[model samples]
Target: MTEPNSKDPAPSPLGRRERLLLAAIAAALGLLLFQLRGGLQPQAPLEQMARRSLELPVALANGRPTILEFYADWCAVCRSMAPAVEAIETKHRGALDVVLLNVDNPRWAAEIERYDVNGIPQLEFFDREGQSVGRSLGGRSLAELDAIATALIAGKPLPRLAGVGSLSQLDVASTPVAGPRSHG
Candidate 1:
């Protein structure tokens, strides 16, 4: 064939439709990668369970109550507990120790198994010697968490059924009321 005319438009690159389709596929792949990366990455700092070393036991041995929370990245209850746990951290700063352990991490997986964490939002209270004094599993409301913290600080036994109750089953009667109700 005759040499391509110099002025001829370079063989049409990808057509508009082809370009659009390629772009769409690229965008879809990008979105998929982003989602996969997010899922694989650790949870956000505020949302992540705190990690502590064995030194935690030494701190507990100093006669302070320690709150140890075991959580996973995909757990909705764990995410819900984030704010309350932070509030507890702030409220009991220096008085009560708080530690978060990510069960997804292999380093703490043994502890997770040892503690028998079958669900998200596993809360364990440790005495001065690092012994587990009490534990509550599943979701907990702010008030219930506060009560548990208070009990830990006071060296009193945490109510067995207090924070472990299902949210669907929680009712006005289940909550602890401080003031007398007015029937009038």
Candidate 2:
């Protein structure tokens, strides 16, 4: 090291106060990134959605349009799509009946077979005449659910869904659909 030259103007190392300010700025950035992580992923349960379990034959016999929601308690897609489904129910109120069928529950085993419910979050629609309208599998956006419910109430053609297969009145004669992964 050379002798100290107090008169010479040179860049000095960061003082303790400066170091602390940098650390605080870095910590704030870290916190911001952490918050952004949550914003990046698909968020579920938009609101506390209200749904009710149902008995298939009885619910269908009520002489109203029915939407059978096949789900399992452990299913993430079911949990997430819940608020949207509830919105449909709230939208259609008296004219439509929303049925919650827990696939894991033995009570709904027969319904599971009748609908060939291999995937969770399946939204099955039935017209007032007790005819099958269509069924949507996997995750569905709020708009999709809204469309289906609106169409169902108006007796219009149900919107076709992608990623997961859907069954319409015209396609009921086709073969059944098998295993499909659920969403979160």
- Model 2 per-residue lDDT tens digits across residues 120-169: 77778998887997877787888988888778878899987677733222
In angstroms, the error of model 2 at 39 is 27
**TM-score (all chains, Cα) for each model:** 0.60, 0.59
Q: Can you give the lDDT of residue 101 in candidate 2?
A: 66
Error of 1 at 19 (Å): 23
Per-model lDDT: 0.68, 0.69
State the lDDT of candidate 1 residue by residue for 1-184, as single tens digits. Answer: 7887888777667889999999999999998988876756745644343643224556568777888877655666777777888788779776788888765555554566678766667778886566788888787877887887888888888756643543222122332333445221
Clashing pairs for model 2 are none
Q: Point out where model 1 deviates above 4 Å.
A: 1-55, 162-184
Best by lDDT: 2
